[model samples]
Target chain A: MSRPSDVYLFGTCLVDLFMPDAGMDAITLLETLGIRVHFPQAQSCCGQPAYTSGHPREARDVARSQLDLFPGDWPIVVPSGSCGGMLKHHWPTLFAGEPEQERVVAIAARVVEFSDFLLNHLDWQPVDTGPATRVAVHTSCSARREMNVHTTSWALVDRLANVTRVVHDHESECCGFGGTFSIKHPDIAGAMVTDKARALEDSGAIEFVTADAGCLMNINGKLALDKATPLRGKHLASFLLERTGGKS
Target chain B: MNSQPVTLYPSRQFKDNARAALADTELRGSLRSAMDFLMAKRSSAFPDTDELDALRTLGEAIRQRCLSRLPELLEQLEERLTANGVTVHWAETPAQANAIIHGLVAARNGTLMVKGKSMVSEEIELNHHLEAHGIQALESDMGEYIVQMAGEKPTHIIMPAIHKTKAQIARLFHEKLPDTPYTEDVDALIRIGRNALREAYLQADVGLSGVNFAVAETGTLCLVENEGNGRMCTTVPDLHIAITGIEKVVEKLEDVVPLYSLLTRSAIGQPITTYFNMISGPRRPGEKDGPREVHLVLLDNGRSQAYADQQLRKTLQCIRCGACMNHCPVYSRIGGHAYGTTYPGPIGEIISPHLLGLENTRDLPTASSLCGACGEVCPVRIPIPEMLMRLREESQRPAGEAVDHPLRGQGAAASTTEALAWRAWRRVYASPGTYRLFGWSATRLRALTPPTQAGWTQNHVPMTPAPKTLHELVREREARRKES
Candidate 1:
């Protein structure tokens, strides 16, 4: 598919509330690339938390609200791979046998993860202008397996010339921010995030960046609580924009 | 013969069990190292990603095809085994399977039954049941033998004593057996275990084993293992009784090729196991040394329930490869014992709900983070994460709800409060206006966000909302664009 001049930005609920700057930076990155980034004001959650928690009805109800929000046939770029997966992969399954199944499938076809859109669609080759520094990248499980955009995220990070991308131990492992999973099983989640944080800090990178906000919240939250590690995390979009000389 | 009954940890106590497991630094270190080793082995074994994908695809197709015709295949298996002089017994429950085996042993007046590795036996609590009837069931496989001697259940399906370190095993052996010196050397430990079980294999009146595949076309029961005990148990004793789930049936002998290849590689990173035994039936008149009497017990035990659903049926496609567990983040921390079920990890999370009622195993399904590692690594490509979500949905379904095929313990995990929360969540996110209003208040009242958010604040700081919502920021950017 050819690059489109216009795209819809589905700023996920986590970014909309907890890390709005990441969403703004994502918009700036797209706008700087000469693409019209349409921020659908009506959009909220991607219904991922509910869908993954096994409440499909609630998920479908919420997902249906965004079905018609992007009806212009333009690509719906999701900053979060988890939400993008919900739209691209699971939405049709959630709407199977329903009256809006066709519509859901059509919308699913147009859903593109943030980094995937940048690297694959637009062939984005970001020139690094920021100070030379080492950083780690944490790809969400959804980004790795569900959306299969982890490589895309890594490639975008690798495109930065002066920035050194350090690899962490168990880099592909989940940070335990599995939506309701962290809530339902705190001890297990805590153990997982603790290990993940330790791995990131031990990677010798000063900071970390992830494309998904949930993992950023999880790893950052753990790092904050531990206070033993100087390592921090940011969304990949924000990190990429800042690295590429775009205003954060 | 007078051994104590096996102790069972209930799945309901999963949370508490997980807490204890997490606190055990020893267990965490051991499991992390073991998982790392296994993951590396598996990765190296399947070096060619394209070949691995092709094999997994073929493996999945074979399982799905066989499962689609499970009923017919099972019947054909029974007929072919009977024709081959193997007495086939059909059991719908664990109790029935146990009774059938007990009757077989009683007919022979068997007092001692030597056994190979069998997860099915563990599933039915066969050792305890036989011990109750004054029959001694000795485990011949080294891992099973060690676990049995310790009077503990097997922690892992493939490696029963995997949870125990070499020092721990040496200690157990020195304490449990007579004249056994404590030895931490792996070779020495194996020799001691072999010596301990060698006498039982000779004196055993009956032998028991588990089948990996029961090919209907050939009436052969296939057993895969690195240990030679499976061969001994099936051949040394006069009476050999092999037990397995009914879902183990395949259509043809050749179909076992790709499945076995996938199984061994996915399981232990071995292209093929050291020993792959195929037992068609009891020893023929001309046969010199094999068991004279062979019995195949096919147990249905909640498998038919899983097979009844199109989606859940994929759970049966598993080839007993522990790759899923080896790659699972949750299982790596908690280990198999914490799962409190015969099978553990990703496979257990999905299959246990059907084996035991969802009411008993409700927590198992939600135990995963749904990271998709299990599904990704699965040899037969069972969509484990999707099945977990499906089971979770089934467990949370309202009790007495009208559905064509309700799970045994449907609505077991359902709570009115949780349901109400989702309902409220639906109201807010299902509309643009309500979501905007909620987000506005959330950002504006960010300071009021509690520092003591339950669960989340346990290992992390409180998650506070930003000062402004993305919507407001985007709107401001749009206004700037309009001004320009």
Candidate 2:
């Protein structure tokens, strides 16, 4: 497939509120590649929280609101794989039997995760301008299974010549920030994140990068609380922009 | 027959149970090592991804085809078994199944029944019922034997004693059995268990086992196990009884090829188990050393209810490989006992609601992080995560909502507050204006964000919004671009 001249950025809710810099960096990286990025102001949450929580009606209502925003044929690039999966894979199921089913399916077909859009569509190969640094990559379950872009995320990171991608133990396991699951079963979620944090820290990386904001927040929050280690996490978009010398 | 109720961890106390299980360092270490080993074994067993995918697709198609004609296949199975001189019994409930088995034993004046590993028997609390009626149901499978000897429920479907370390098993044997010395040596432990169970096989008036697959076309009941205990249990006694869920039936014996291959490989990474017993019927005329009577008890136990819905019928496709639990992150963390059901982990979360009702197993569905590992690793391609989400929907549906097929105890976990919160979330997110305003205010008042956020803040710091929303950042960039 040829690279599109224009694309729409679906900055997920977590990126919009908790990590605005990541969203901005995503636009910067896209723009640096000579592609015109369109940010639709009407976009909001992907309704994944309610969708996975079994509230389909509410999830549909919220998800339906964004269907009209991306009216163009340009690919919709989502920085977070979790939200990207909700749009690409689950929207059809959410709108099944409804009049908007075709519309949702068409929109879902154009949905592309950030790493996948960069690695596959554009074939991005960035020149490393930053200092030598080692970083670990954390792939969300949605990215790994739902969107099937975990390898693309890793390959995108591996493109940086100066960055040494360290592999963590249980790299495929969940970081346990399962939206409401963290709030519902905190102890289990805590145990999962604790193990994930320890693994990342033990990987000898100064920082970890993930393509999903939920995991970034969960891992960083746990690391912030633990004064024992100074290891923190960064969103892949920002990390990529930083390594590629794009102004953040 | 009145029997002592089977000991249960009670799904209602899932939170407490998970907390308790997580606190046990020994159990955590054992589960961690076991899961790692099993995962590695399974991965290496199927080194070719393309071949694995093709096999899984075939396995799924076979199960779906069999389930599409479940009623007809079940009837055909009964007819073929009957023609082959085997008694086939249908049970709609656990109590009815127990009564049928108890009556059979009582008719034979059986004082002891040597049993192979059977989770269905555990589901019906058959041992307790038999013991209540002056019958001893001795578990002959090594794992099941260890669990029964300790008077504890099997923690895992495939490996009942997986939770117990060898040292723990040695201590259990030394304390529970007569004149048994404590020995942590694995070989010695197996010898001791085998010796103790050897006499029970001969003394048992009846033998019982579980069927992995019931072939309707061939009238053969297939049993897969690593140990020879299942074969011994079926052949040693004068009478043998096999119990299984109604969903275990396959239309043709050939259909079992892909399923059996996938089951062992996905389960413990074994290409084939040590013993694969195919019992068609009782000893034929002049046949040597086979049981005189063979009976199969097909128990519904809420399976028909699951079969009623097209989407839910997929839950019946499970081959009981226990691969889902082994691959599940939540199961690895909390272990199987924390689930408090006959089947646990991803499969249990979906199936338990049907068996025990959503009200009794409300928390089971929501126990996972929606990690998708179980669904990915499933041999027969059971969409376990999707089924879990569906169960969660059933558990929280409105009290009086109408549907084509309502699950038992629907809306058991529904909460007015949770519903209202989602409603509020929809209202804010569904509108561009409200969402923008909410984001703006949230960021502006980020300092007022509370330090403690119920469960989230229990371990980590509070989540504070950024000073500027993406909407604002994008707007500023657009303005600057136009000005430049």
lDDT of 2: 0.92
Off by over 4 Å in 2: B1-6
lDDT of 2 by residue, A28-112 (tens): 9999999999999999988999988989999999999999999899999999989999999999999999999999999999999
Docking level of model 2: high
Question: Model 1, B95-183: lDDT tens per residue?
Answer: 99999999999998999999999999999999999998989999888888888888888877887877788888999888888898988
Off by over 4 Å in 1: B1-4
Q: Which ten residues in a row have the lowest lDDT in candidate 2 chain B?
A: B1-10
Categorize the docking of model 1.
high
In order, the first chain's TM-score in every candidate is 0.98, 0.98
lDDT of 2 by residue, B296-323 (tens): 9999999999999999999999999999
